[model samples]
Target chain A: MSILDSIRTALRAIAANRLRSGLTALGLVIGVASVIVLIAVGQGAQQGVQERIRGLGSDLIFVKPAAQTDRSTGARGAQGGGITLTAADADAITEAKIPGVVGIAPQLSFNAQAIAQSQNLGVTIIGTTPSYADVRDARVAQGAFIGADDIDRRSLTIVLGSAVAASLFPDGDAIGQQVRIALGPQGFNFRVLGVMEPRGGTGEQDNYAFIPVSSLSARFQFLRNPRGDISVNQINIRTAPGAKQEPIETAITDVLAQRHQVVTPDFTVQSQNDLVGAAAEVSRTLSILLGSIAGISLIVGGIGTMNIMLVSVTERTREIGIRRAVGARGTDVMRQFVTEAIVLSLVGGLIGTGIGVGVAMGIDGRDISGTAMQTAIQTWSIVLAFGVALLVGLISGSYPAFRAARLDPILALRSE
Target chain B: MIHLENVEKVYRTEAGEVRALDGVSLDVQAGEFIAIMGSSGSGKSTMMNIIGLLDDPTAGTYTLDGADVSKLDDDTRSKLRGRLFGFVFQSYNLVPRMTAVEQVELPLLYQRGTNRRAMALEALDRVGLADRASHQPNQLSGGQQQRVAIARSLVVHPNVILADEPTGALDTRTSEEVMGIFGNLAREQRITVVVVTHESNIADFTNRTVRMRDGLIISDERRLQVIPSSASSPDASIPVSEVGS
Candidate 1:
């Protein structure tokens, strides 16, 4: 029989028992769909992170404590260690006059509830210099930022993010207003100096309340390092326009290392490209993990296909015998059964691909709770899913087809 | 013409060797209608299997039309079977979901023959089933199903039609009806018909009866007339050899 004839015959046979065929195909359909959907999710997450990093502004670098790897004991210290960087380090970097350095903003933030009379909302209270507005690409929408005088005087002054400003005082004018920021049982009132412009970037830029680092050390006495300097959690560094970030980061690292009397700096500098690359690496691993997990289901679906084919071959023993009796060659019988299996998987694969693409598109740009889910349906994923399904069908069908083809005509005919 | 020379078939068992057919020789001419008769395990089935090319004999040669068919390869054997033999079974053996026309087209389908639907219809018409061509097996009665099977056998234009207890599952009326079709096929179409059965009454419908006992044929003789004569029976006055094959 030709391939077409075999397919027709297989279709008829499958149609004779519709429920079983549908059930058999369902496994593969689910298998392919999940693989595509999950990989799209991973891709979306990666893109989301990269976009947020870019949103923080281009040509930027941030500093944190380096993870310390001890050679003798072979033990390592976790990153962002205690007092990794302080006001002293920032002062030393600024004094070093590192070329291409545009601005520096050292920050230490604490999560606190902000109470503007009756209206209260939980927000992070950030302690940073006035240059934070320029270095991090933040701008004032209503009033001025925390000026140099505010830091020198250690004044209780606050800058509200657009979202926080709107939440605290919905009546428009939030400037020069008094708001109490409470850390645990202690609360302090600050004059709102400015409201930041609406800059969407992973929700952080819109939610934080900015304060001077010196005021934070005075308000929370325990924030000072053992060396009697204000502790800084992170320091934001901006580079000159059209300048490379690598040299500035290297210079800062050198200055910090020398001041700390160490061969390598106690802090680590991460540039924009480094952060994007890191996010991509993490996301790629997630995609592969999700893909393989989905692949296991595909394999299971393949096994399910084999199971259905074997049952079909057994159930149609007499039918095989009848065909053999009528002059069907063994190869014809083999081809017919194998074709049946392939058709089952092929149908399932097509359906799964359709549903997968549909689900991915359906979930794309949709708001889940509060966050919008982003998805990118990849062409390779669809192609790979379909190709694997056909291959699975071919592999799973061979054994059963062989069994059918090798049956003795007399015995097969005799079977009920 | 068909020929067999001292054919022997032995099946090995875990306990010992059991001879199913031993030194049996039989010849069936073209256009001849014959019956092979014996009790169960009497070697009649084994001989029929050998003659139908479904089994190989332990020793001896079987010739069909002029070729030594016993040593043929599977593909050639399948081709020869498609071209030369048709099978009718006790239970009809019609695929359950296929229409009568499609069932008839089965033999030609394996041969990859063209104009299959038209040829299948013509074959069905031969057994007066052309009107019921699209009816599945479940939609037809047992006798009609058997007739459809006969049409399937005829669609290939086989040189020989072999039936293994073809009427084993049919009633008296359907059995006679089927046997009549076989008789008409042999005498009128000049096609060979071989039926295997233990029933002496079924044997009366054929031209010759060969009885087997313990792996050996003890009797081979001619039946003078087709019994239960009806208007559709072949003309009794004509000699079997006078019919052109």
Candidate 2:
């Protein structure tokens, strides 16, 4: 028979047992859907994480104090007793004159209570210079932010985080307004100079207030030891365009080491670029793990297809015999059955892809807490899932198809 | 033409070897209508199967249309079967779901590279079942079903038609109608027809008869020619021995 005739015959045979064929196809659909959905979700999560990392300037680097050892035990550093990064270290970075050095902001953060009207909201207070706005891409929604004068003269000025401003001044403007902020054992009032634009919280820096570094050090007193010198908790550095980051980071490390008089590399200087790289690696691993789990369902679907095909062969033994007697070659019979299997799987793969894409879109549209993860259905995932499904169909269908083809005509004709 | 030389067919059962056709030799010429008569287990069916190329002989040099069919492989045997023989069975063996036209079309389909529908229609017309072509096997009478089977066999224009108890499951009147169709095909079309029947009455429909006993031909005889005018006249003399028997 011609290819068209064989296809028609195979379709007719499958149509004869509609319920069985549908059930077998359903198995493949579920299998392919599982793989598609899992991989899509994994890809979405990875994309979301990378987006968050990108949102925080890819070239930005963070430096934190490393562990300090106790002289008696000589084991490891005290968990909270590390030396602070002072403004002198920030100035030392300027002296090195490294190219691609955009901005450096010395930061000190502490939990404090801000009282406006009769309401009191506890929030973290971040103290940094004017350069923080450009480096962090922070924009003021209402009024102007703290400038170099505020950091130089220790002006009592602050900028409210979008969420914090909303809570403290429910119905009024926060700009040019004074809010009393009680820090630790002492309380002080600072004028709110600006209200930040709404940025949905990302990472660990949500619900905080920003103030001038000099104002924070002078008023809080705990921000400085008895040395009457400015102290910083951490330093944030933004790199310039087209400049290699590793060399600049090394220069920063050397500058901080000489200023702090620490012999060993006692601080952690991490590049945001490296963090992004690490996050991508983690996402990739997660996607593979999820894809494997989805692959299991595909395998189960394949087995189901094989099992159903085997049963079909047994059920249609007499039919096969009749066709054989009518001069159908063994290879022809094999081709017919295998084609049916592939059709089933391909249909399943298509349906699963639709369902998976719908699910990814649904999840992406919903509003949730923390970093908002984005989902994007990759074309390769679709191709891979469908290809795997087709392959599974062929692998699963071969044995039963071969068995049907090899049946003796006489014995099959006699089969009940 | 069909020729069998020292044909032997052995069946290997758990009990032991049983010879179905023990050194049987026979020759059938083209256009001859022959009936094979034997009791059950006398190997008449085995001989029919071997003749139809449905089973191979254990040891034989069987020639059909000048080719040694007994030595051919399965595929070659199948091809030759399609080209050389058409079959009718006691059960009709019409694919139950198929319409009469489809049943007739089957043989032509195996012949390949032919317009199956035209051949099938012509075959159905030859069997006088052109109008009943669309009716499935279940809708047709026993005689009509047998006619469809005959059409199926004749559609491919094979060298011979092989009938294995063609009327074994039909009523006496239906059997007569089926046998009449076979007689017309052999007489008018001059196509060879071989039938297997144990009934002596069934053997009378053929031009020649061969009776088997103990896997061997006990008697082979040609019937007396019928005068057409006497066959149609009421004053035709009936043989006294046949009437008394």
Candidate 3:
């Protein structure tokens, strides 16, 4: 038979059992839909993390304490322990005049309970210099940030993060208001100077209360390190425009090693690229894992389709014999069965894509944790899913079609 | 024209080997209406299968027209069958979903041709079934369904028509009606017709009869021809063309 005639024959056979054909296609539909939805969610999560990391500025570097690895005992200290980073290190790095040195901001923070006139809440209290706002690309939405005069005078003044302001005074203004912070039995009252611009959907950076470093050091002497100097937790560094990062990182490592009187540095420095790369690696692994899990369902669906096709071939043995008698070759019979299988999968795949895309669009919003959980479906994923479905149809239909083709025409004709 | 020389067909089963056609030879000329008559297990069906090219003879030279078709490939044999022979079964074997016209269009679908609709309609007209062309098999009577099958056979314009127990599923009246159609096809259209049956009355409509016993033909005879009554009826009004195919 001609190819068109074979297709027509296949369509007629499928139309004869509409309900059975629909049920057979259900497995494939679920398989393809799950694959699309899972990949979309995985890619969206990966992109969100990468975008947040990029918001930290491309030329930025972070320096923090590294845990000590003991050679003799073969045991490791707690993470971010061993050596303490202090404001003196920040000053010394600034004094060395490194080639790509631009600006440096040192900060120390601890969780504390804040008390207002009628509200009480747990908040992160940060002690940093005025240069922090510029270094971290933070903008003051109202009033002003901690100034240099306030630091020199050791003034008890504070700036609130957007979230902190919203919770402390839900119905009124927060600037010029007074709030008391208690850290380790030491209570201090500070004036709220300003509120930071809202950074919605950011996990941690959107909810901190900032104070000048000199004021926190004077009021809270317990913060002094074992070496008898006020210590800072981390240092944020920025590079000059068009400057290479490798040379600058090497220079910082050398300067810190010499100042600390150690052959190896006590701190770890991570560039923005390294951070983004790590995050991207995690997202890629998650995407692959989810895609493979969904692929298993598609395979199971294909197997179900094959089972139905075999039953169909057996049920139509007499029809096959008739076609054979009327001049149909073995290949003609095989083609008709294969075409039926392909049509089943192709139709199911299309319907699945529609459902997947609709579900993805329905849940396109950030979750309660302020991390976006929305899906982003790529064009290539849709195409790949559809192509894989077609391939599955062809593979699963082969054995049954081959069996039908090999039946003896004489015996087939004798079948009722 | 058809010729079979010492044809042998042996079938192997778990019980043993059984020879269905053991060195049977026969000849059928163009425009000849013949009946292959035999009792149960007399190899009449096997002979029909071999003559229809649906099975291969183990030791034989079967020639159709001028070509030796005994050793032809399966696809080539199928092509020749489609072009030169038509078949009708006892069950009528019409596809359940197809209408009468679609059933007739099936054989021509395998060949390179145009005007398929017109040809299918013309074949249905020849069987006096042009008005019932839109009816499915379930909607037609047993005799009408068999006439549809005959129309399908005629659509291919084959040189020979092979019918296996064509009237075995019909009543006395329907069987006579089917036999009359076959008679008109042989005499008026000059097409060869071969029928396989065990009934003596069914065999009387044909011009020749070959009787088989065990696995071989024991008698071959040419009886006096009896013109079917349908040829004289008013319903046999199919147009006669001046050109012959």
Who wins the lDDT comparison?
A: 1
Model 3 lDDT tens row, A1-416: 67787778777888889898888888788888888888998898888888889777668877777778899998988756654688888888899998887888888888898888888878998889898897788889999999999888989999998888888888758999998998877999999999998866554666789998778878897776767655777788888866887787888778777887887778877777788999999999999998998899889889988999899889888888887888777887788889888888888899888987877776668563775576889787788878888888887778788888888888888898
Summarize candidate 1's per-residue lDDT along A48-92 as a digit string, tens digits: 988998998988889887787778997887876555788778888
Clashing pairs in 3: none
**Which consecutive 10 residues in model 3 chain A have the weakest lDDT in total?**
A363-372
lDDT (C-alpha) at residue A121 in model 2: 91
Clashes of each: 0, 2, 0
Pick the winner on DockQ between candidates 2 and 3. Answer: 3
What lDDT score is found at residue A36 in candidate 3? 88
Give the chain A TM-score for each candidate. 0.89, 0.90, 0.93
| lDDT tens readout by residue for model 3, B1-245 | 79999999899989899999999999998888898999989999999888899888988889988778888888887788888889999999998888999999988887888888899999999989999999999999998999999999999998999999999999877787787888878887888999999887777677788999888999998855445546323121222112111
Candidate that beats the other on DockQ, 1 or 3, i.e. the better one? 1
True contacts kept of each: 0.55, 0.09, 0.55
Ranking by lDDT: 1, 3, 2
Fraction of native Cα-Cα interface contacts (under 8 Å, chains A and B) also present in model 3: 0.55
Candidate 3: segments with Cα more than 4 A from true spot: A68-78, A81-83, A183-186, A201-203, A220-222, A366-372, B231-245
TM-score of each: 0.91, 0.84, 0.92
**Candidate 3 CAPRI assessment class:** medium
How much is the lDDT of residue A110 in candidate 2?
A: 77
Per-candidate alpha-carbon RMSD to the true structure: 4.0, 4.6, 4.8
